[model samples]
Target: MFVSTPRTEASILHADLDSFYASVEQRDDSSLRGRPVIVGGGVVLAASYEAKAFGIRTPMNGRDALRLCPQAVVVHPRFSAYSDASKAVFEIFRDTTPLVEGISIDEAFLDVGGLRRIAGPAADIGQRLRERVRDEVGLPITVGIASTKFLAKVASAVAKPDGLLLVPPGGELKFLHPLPVERLCGVGAVTARKLHDHGIRTIGEMADVGETVLVSMLGGGAGRHLHDLSWARDPRPVHVGRRRRSIGSQRALGRRPKSAEDIDAIVVGIVERLGKRLRAAHRVSRTVVLRMRFDDFTRATRSHTLYESTARNDAILGVARRLVAGATPMIGERGLTLIGLSLTNLENDDAVQLALPFDADANGALDVTIDSLRDRFGTAAVTRAVLLGRDQGMVVPMLPD
Candidate 1:
């Protein structure tokens, strides 16, 4: 490869961990290395590259996966271990650069433009980052460096399984034009099929066509977006944040089937935790979203947006319950595997007028009272009537209120 300094420099780096959960399994147990490993039995959580070679994929049914690679070893998910690994990897990212934007626990975008004088070029920083993660965390990670976040992400995908790739600033089109249209973000199976019908297969072909023509073929938003992306005109920045776009919690159920009462208790546990977090952070949300995964390896999401935002547990739970109830038929048909709740459309609690001091119904005083009591004593000290003497699903990652 001819490495050169173009008219402009590549300064954005996208770093992603490879097969995070399965890799963690390999790192801890020597027996799992060099062999195919599958995490999660009912549904695949993560599959090692060796297992992936045999066509095993995450979220696939374990039965189908075993049918493909019967020799593969299946391991239950240890979220605590995975969470610790994610934290360590993220710490390395923060140490590597202050301008780190975490997209997920396992991946981030690092802006290294101003660090050239201090930490060498972006390419050098990326290489050092990979070495540090591999040596310190005992995990293989891939990094891609480019002028734009989109290009950087693409470069990283091209250099997978512990590799580094740098796309020079002026040569982004040269690197992207020949790749399939599916490589572009937002081009799922349906959009790809539509493009395939139009005989447009690569980004270069998209670049050759006019945006107006594309609009005629694929509607306005998709047309304009794809046209700009084909020419490498992405201007979206890597956003850094404290409060996320959404806060959510999920629990996986094994093969055992549960009654409607069992499911409602699970919902209560999730909303109880989320409601406390929302108010503690001084935030309010207008949307309650329910995410469900079925035994058939399919997933569905239902959401309800309230006319007004609230941080009250009863308000949020009312909407969450309705959303879940609406999906009961699908749940019965597909069989339940995982359930989760997320609060979205969030804003500062002050968006609505703060209630007068000690107002119970309007400002959720009872909820606040419960929070204080739990803080003083243990969470088990106070409980809702419905949750009394029941074993709700464990709240992983999030502390109980």
Candidate 2:
């Protein structure tokens, strides 16, 4: 096994942007500061710290969010702007350490173990990182410093909305045990509910249980996984290579009203292009995520994960189209201003897969033929029948994480 350096100091840092979309709104428009700002009018993409004070949170339905905070100002998403900010901040993260793991567009784990002499202590480095993001990117970021990834993430969560927290080495348990069991990564609402019913509300309480018992409670793998996390035993490193967990593309639509056929065409266009890109990367993804923002400035995401991974466009598009169709009612209620798709839970081409079935006509041979034509001639050389003259969306290059 590969062993890392001794965890004598809190060397891992988890830096996360604060209410990223909403923060950008506040940063650009001075009038929005100190006010409840909601990004995404139909679904809550992000809520400013001010709106959060009113019990507003992200991914909440826009209608419900407005009901909670009626005075909130909602804005449509600017993907280009958010993408630019993410690139700039990630540049800072790369500059901080070569070993930077980007968890999402807005958060990363930075390993600064060997930079003590050059960059001072880890906590100090974390503070300086937050400052750089605020000063350079015009965004507020919170950072957490600890000996392990799990503890670092928890520390950042505890110190939210532009705060820096450091969990001292050897004091990880002291800091972690008091927190709720839900603080453990991967423990969602259902998992937490199960744990709560069993009287395991806090990490400390959960840690007191035997591993075998935890396995019995949360299934073997999850039980052991949570058991280790509750004990602050995360050994994962800040994986280098900036491998993004998902690859996505989106296009912004103006306030023009679109018919269901028009929307479906955009979806088809996006998926056809994205599928080509996925195969080029020599990877297969299990999840197809559909993200939409309505003219009402509300956003919502629907994702479907396939049991077996596949790189074929037809297979991924099949899943993508279904997710869009399922959201049709919501689309009718709110006019969509943006349409996007992301492929997640990726795996290597050689990974083992289940016996999920696909139509025999949807073969890699045909996909390879189309891709070859597109490569030699250009994307416009081979067009899906649905995208012809239908205002197919642009495929802009996403800024590197």
After superposition, candidate 1 runs with Cα above 4 Å error:
1-8, 249-263, 290-302, 325-340, 350-352, 356-362, 365-401
Report the lDDT of model 2 for residue 203. 96
RMSD (CA, angstroms), candidate 2: 7.1
In model 1, which residue pairs have backbone atoms overlapping below 3 Å? none
lDDT of 1 by residue, 290-331 (tens): 999999867899998998888999989999889989999998
Residue pairs in collision within model 2:
41-297, 41-298, 42-298, 43-299
* Top-TM-score candidate index: 1
RMSD of 1: 5.0
Quote model 1's TM-score: 0.84
